[model samples]
Structures are given as structure tokens and as C-alpha cells.
Target chain A: MNNEKVWTAGLVVIGDEILSGRTADKNIAQIASWLQVQGIRLAEVRVVADDMDAIAGAVNALRTAYDYLFTTGGIGPTHDDITVDAIAAALGVDVVIHPQARAMLEDYYKDKPGGLNDARLRMARVPDGADLIPNAMSGAPGIRHGNIFLMAGVPAITAQMLHGLTGQLEGGAPLMVETVGCWTAESEVAEILREVEKAHEGCQIGSYPFFREGRTGANFVIRSTSRDVLESAVDTLCEALAETGRDFTPGGI
Target chain B: MNNEKVWTAGLVVIGDEILSGRTADKNIAQIASWLQVQGIRLAEVRVVADDMDAIAGAVNALRTAYDYLFTTGGIGPTHDDITVDAIAAALGVDVVIHPQARAMLEDYYKDKPGGLNDARLRMARVPDGADLIPNAMSGAPGIRHGNIFLMAGVPAITAQMLHGLTGQLEGGAPLMVETVGCWTAESEVAEILREVEKAHEGCQIGSYPFFREGRTGANFVIRSTSRDVLESAVDTLCEALAETGRDFTPGGI
Candidate 1:
């Protein structure tokens, strides 16, 4: 394996609705997938409430822990949308309305009803020294303060913001993955999986077991920064499974 | 509002697949909803990979931070399933095969082909002095080590385990909720939501906005420990929406 730098990012999903189970969070997976393609590993995720302290605490903790910190939710114009304010507090900065964002919102709402009222104009507010992450889906742009990104809670808007951010950040070698599925109990091959993972350098395997159709089975995912190592590990695991008289699928179940 | 002791819980989701974006997490919502019914608030959630240190760190942090701590994933029979070991390390305890869990698994797998093999028996392992939380859906029971719980990752299995645990925990008065939906932009009523929540001493209001069918709308949820306060807050919000000449739905849109 090459001694390449690994970039890591931390995500903080800010929403009380998520904690209340009123909203099943889509941002975690969306951001994780997006970061993976950017060659950045999503090292950790924290789901916090809409409260200002909670949001600020998570942002501060994650921003210092990872190369990048992405916060989703609470960027809206409502009272509960306190992410920008919280993040500002975390950065020891003052919140101010950005001229560019204000102009964008004015243009977007000029022909529409309600026409940029106080609540709608609240979207223009950002941290004092922050820049904007373009939002293709809506007029409200995302805030980019230092390495921290403040995004929309709406999945569609978050997607647009991420799309606009693609290829903008620096990344390292992307992790490659291979999956092998077997129609047998994972316990039946615990020793083999452990030994194979131990033998492989820079490669880790994860076993996900499932019970379906009155039968037990598992899918093993092999991941590594090097494709050759990942493939070699997968081959060894496949051989071991075959030797045990277990039928295995290459691409998983 | 009556002064009652509030119970809070934290969840640590341990899985590489979740962080890899290969799996969309259902356990967070499931556990959150279950905890709500049990009157325990899900205070925070952390999603970490399958690494032992990550799991142990999250477990130790959350277990100490909240009244109760629950973990999902990495508790199966595979080598990668190290939640039991991780939690044991976090609690400074030795790993032991619980005799009761072993007997239960033996009885459960007697008619199955595997028939309680060494790998399958691994499911019986728990931290020394830990008790079993019954699993009605599968053979492997959940682990209850003091105030910490280790549950399965699969949503179906987690649901069954939670069902087995319902009404078993001590909690405060359940937070009552009332939702008001309006086919108007949330920003348009931001002040109203803030003022209503502030006027109600014991209540909190969350505004969730959406854009659908070429129209912007929002759902406002009012939550409080006292039913009277919750109802009063909802009434005030509804009246404000009416005074603004906006049509609102009582339940949600």
C-alpha cells in the first residue's frame, strides 16, 4: 500500500425532527456518498437537536476533529433554523446579511408572491467572513465558513449544494470496495474472515449478516485505499468460502 | 408544568456500511420513536465505523453523558461483530459467555442446521455481569449491561428487541405534541412561531418547510411536557396563522 494522505470529514446532522423520529434523515447517507466520491472518508456523524447550543457544540467538536465539517439542516428561514447563528457562535464571529445572498433572494422573489419579507430575507444572513456555496435548486445559497459548510435541511436543496461543491475540495486516494455474498451463516466463517483480514495489509473487511427465506446469509465488504489489495483480499475470501463448500456471489446478494 | 425527572438516552450506531453510504440507517428513527413511546428522550446519536476504538469511545462517552445508552450493530456472530467486546472494554469488564444466553441459543438453534456451533455461540458472549434483553424475533438476545443496551442493527430485529423493552424503563411525563400545517412558506410565519413558543413557557415549536406542487408550505410542531401547555401553544399558533389569513391544517399536510 502506498503511504498516501487520507482526508476525512465529519458530518453533523442538525434537526429535532430527526431526533423525534418525525423525519428519517437522508442527509447522512447523501453526504457520506458525496464525500466518498470526493476521496474523503466520512469519519464520524453526530445527529443533534435544533437547539442553538446543541448545534454549536457539535459544529465546534467536529470542525476541529476532521479536515472538513459538514452540517445539514437548520439553514432555513424559520425560528428553528438557527444553524448559521450557531455556527457563527462556534467560530466566534458575528452574523450578518450577505449582500450577494440578499440580491439573489430579491431577484428570485421579485416576481413571486410574499416578495422577500423579513422571514424570507432571513436566508440572506451568514457569518461575517463566510462565502456562499451556490444553490442550484433554490435562491438561498449555502454558507461556507472556513472548512465548515452549512447546508439546507431539505434533501433536494442539500443535493444541489453538494453538486455545486463537487471537485472544489482537496482529497486523497479514494477507498475501493469489493463485496462477496454467501448463502451461509456469518458465524460459520468467522475464523476465515478474521484470518484473511489479518493477513491483508491496509485492507479491512466488514461482515453484514441477514436472515431471509428461512435461511441465514452474510455479505462481506472489503475496503482498501489500494484496488489491488482490495481485490486480493476478496479473492482470498472467495477461495476460503468456496473451500468450505459455501456458494458465494461475487457482487453480493 | 409539573417538575418531573426527565429520562434521556444516547445512541451509538456502529457500522462501516452506514458510514460508507451502502446502507441507509433505519435504527436511529426506530430507536428514537421507541424511546419516545417509553418517555425517554433520545438526546444524541453518533454513527461510527466498525473499529473497536471508535465503538468503545462512543459507548463510553454516551453512557456517561446520558441516563441510558443504546447501541446498534456489530453484535452478531461474525468476527467483525465486536460490539460486545467493545462495550466490555469500555466498561472495564471481561467478556464471558452468559450461561442463560447460551442455553437460550441452544434451544433456539436445536432444529436448525447450524445447531449452536462455536460461531453461533459467540452471540451468547456478553460483558461479565450483563443481563439479556429478550429478542422475540431472533435467537440471539440483546444485551443489557447496566444502563447500556446492545441491540441488533437490522431494523426488524431492533424493532422486536425494542418491543421486548417497552415500558421497562423509568421515565418522566411524556412530551405531548401538536402539529399545524400551512400551505405557505415557513419564513412567512417565522416571527409567529418564535413568538408563540416564547409566550408558552414550557413549550418548543419546530417549523419544517417543504416545496411541493409548485407551492411552498410548512408544518409547525409544538412539544411540551404538559398537555395543557402543548394544547395552548398549538391554539396560539393556529390563531396566529388564521390572523395572517393563511389556511392551516390541524394535523399536518
Candidate 2:
């Protein structure tokens, strides 16, 4: 592992609808994108059904393996919403209603009629020792353990809770990014690309192939923490490609 | 964990572009769909870069966890094509050109000019003691060893290989499916669902919510091997929903 303050996270998507192919999982892609901008790499993502044993197993493994674990789904007001119990089991704890959570629900439903029924109270059953993670969209808040953040299954609610939690996270320094517009096949530019990668330590380069308007091209993106290192590497790459009679348009720094 | 015959498979998605968000992986979704249709449960999936060690680690872990493992990506004739060598390292063996694979490629590129160069021959390199799995789209074949199916990362080629390998696999009987649709407020329909699930053994029932145009509805999809069992459960579900003043529209069985 690159010990350079890399905070890796894994996502656990708990829903039978996803495993049954009735619903496509939108959380994985959403979380992956959000984490990338914060310089927190999403290491792995697993979509398990609402099965208790499967959820517990995945939650345990992911929480132990990654710096952070985020789970979406099975936290609604229905009988299938067993995520709280499963997480408690995984952590070898018990489900207990936190007073703060109860107060939040009370305040949220105080305005609405027939609010906070027995079924709705299920949403307040947080795992022992968990702190409330605010849900900006709805009154039903998420929960967070040491590094595991448990949010609702619905996309809108999940996005809202994640947005609320983003500001509280510790992010690494700006990871420099540079891109060059495509002109040729990825394979044709591999040899010199490998040499450039070898020359630039502490940097990673990726090649992306694209097609638009009956033309195929690739963009070479280089990322690092050091701007000088990135610039020098991009210079070498452009020079080498130009020597091979291929030109590219430089993009964002 | 069920005492019945269970077929488990794992997926390996190889490509740094996916991790960098330059490319979204489609192979996992395609393979996962095919596996679900065959009564084979997809146990897990790992996405790794084209780096040799990362690919090797994922392939090795998945190979041991499930009954079969399938890998996509890193099989093309590009410089990043390291899946062959990675699989070899994972299995503690060496990769060599298989005669059958070489013949298939030779016949495929016989008419094309400058076809089957050393770069292209890189596709024929299979781990020692592996059988060639046919690639129907392009002639460059995939390889199968024990429970591992190594396939191309390209969507079209991967789908073609999966089709070719279909006849060779042994799978459980197709799981029977029944859907009770257009139920409003899934939480109110939970108790009856539990009772129906208990009555029907060896069946899995899932509730899917769909909200569109300011209307919220749900589908209760039930799966079981016995048609009679599923019908009885569906009948009870419809009867129970009627009591809640929500008449379920019974579609074709």
C-alpha cells in the first residue's frame, strides 16, 4: 500500500432487488464518484441481498479491510429493513434507540399527522454506540460507527446523507491532474508511455479510449500530488508522441 | 448453505480505467445477468487494475471462494494485457502459447494483411494446462482451467465467449418466478408477505418499489422451484392485500 495518507473505502449495497436484477444499483457509482473527488479511493464494492447472514458477513469483511465502510439499503421502515440488526450483529453489539435519534424523529414528525408510528420507530433503532449522521433530505437520519457510515437505501436519501457527511471527512492534498486529447490507438503509444511512467516516480498514468462522430481516439491522463512532477512527465509524453508523428491537444492542469 | 446443489461464481473486472472513472465497467453486469439466468448465484466480484499483482491477488482469492471464477479484461493485444501472466502467477505456473489457440488465431487472420503480428499473438498466450474456450465474435479464444474462465474484457467478445461456454456448463434447474404487482405502501404489506414466505418452502420473495410521476407502487416478486407452491403464495398475498383495501392486479402466471 502507498502509505501516503491514502484513505481507501468500500461500499456495501444491501438490497435483494439489486441481487434479483429488478433494480440496478445507483449507489456504487454515486459513492465512487464522490470519494474520488475527495482523494479517497473506493477499493471494493459488494452488492448483497437483504439476507441477514450475507449482510453481516460483507459488513464485517469490508469494515476490517478498508479505512472506511459505507452501506446503503435495508434501512427503511419495512420488515425487510434489517440493516440495523445486521450491522449490530456484525459488530457484536446490540440495537438500542439513541435519545438523539428519537428526538430527531419526534421533531421531524411533530408537524405531520399520524407521524412516528410503531413501524416508523424502526428507523430509530441504531446500533449501540453509534452517532447520528444527519440526513438533509429526510428526517430519518443515518448512523456512523468508527468508520462505517450506514445510510438509507433510497438514492435521494443516500445522496443527502453523504453530502452531509462529506464536510466532516479528512481529505488528502490536491492530486494534480493533466489530460491530453486523443489521436491514436492505445497500443501504438504503449512503449513510450511505459518508459515515461518508469521515469516519473510517485505518479500514475491512465489511457482512456473514446469514440465520437465516427472517430476513435484516446486521452492520456496523469495524476500526482506534485505539479512539477506531473508537468515534467506530460512534457516527456508529448515529445515522445510528437516524435512518432502524433499530435495531441493539452487539457486541464 | 442450502442442502441443494449450489453453483457459485465470482467476477473479476480488470482495467485501471474503471478505477479512475474513465471507463464504467459493463462486463460485471452482463456476466451477472447470465449467471442469474442459469441458477448460478454470483458470489462476489472484484475490480482491479491491469497491474500483474493486483490481478493475481483478485483471481487467486475468487478462485478459492467460489465454484467458478470468471475474469474480464487484460486479454487484448495491448501492452497492458497482463491477465495471462497474472493468472499464471496466481496458480503458481507459467503461461505458454497453446497449439489450439494458435491455430484458431491463425485461421482467423489468414486473409487480412499484416494480421497476427507478435503483438496479436500475445492473445494466444494461455496458462499451461488450460483448455481453450471458443470466442465466437473474434477467433482469439478464451481459456478455462479447473473452475476459472478467463475471457476478454471487451463487452462483445466477452458475451460471445460466454455464449460459447454455455453448453459446457452444468447448472441447477431454472428458478421459477411469480410477481404480484402494483401494491402501494410496501410496509403495510409486510406481515402477510412473511406468512406467505413461511408457507412456501425453498422460495425467496422480494419487494421492489417503483416511484414515477408522483405515484408510488411496488412489486412483490416470488421465486420458487414449484409452480403450485408459488401460486398458493401469490393467492394468499393477493387475498391479504385485499383486506388492506389495496386490490392487487393479478397478471399472468
Off by over 4 Å in 1: none
DockQ scores for all predicted structures = 0.78, 0.34
The residue-by-residue lDDT of candidate 2 on A1-253, one tens digit each, is 2346877887888886665555656777677777777777777777676888989988998899888898999877666789999999999999998888888888977765446666667778988999998986567899998889998787878888988887577766546678987566464566676779889997777766554565646677887777888999999989998888877889921
Docking class of 2: acceptable
- What does candidate 1's lDDT look like per residue over A89-138, in tens digits? 98999999999999999998898777999988889999899999999777
Give the number of the best model, judged by TM-score: 1
Error of 2 at A122 (Å): 2.0
Please give the TM-score that candidate 1 achieves against the real structure.
0.97
How does model 2 score by TM-score? 0.88
Model 1 local distance difference test score: 0.91
Write model 1 residue lDDT over B118-215, tens digit each, in one string. 88899999999999989977789999999999999988898889988888999877878889999987877888998999999878899888889988
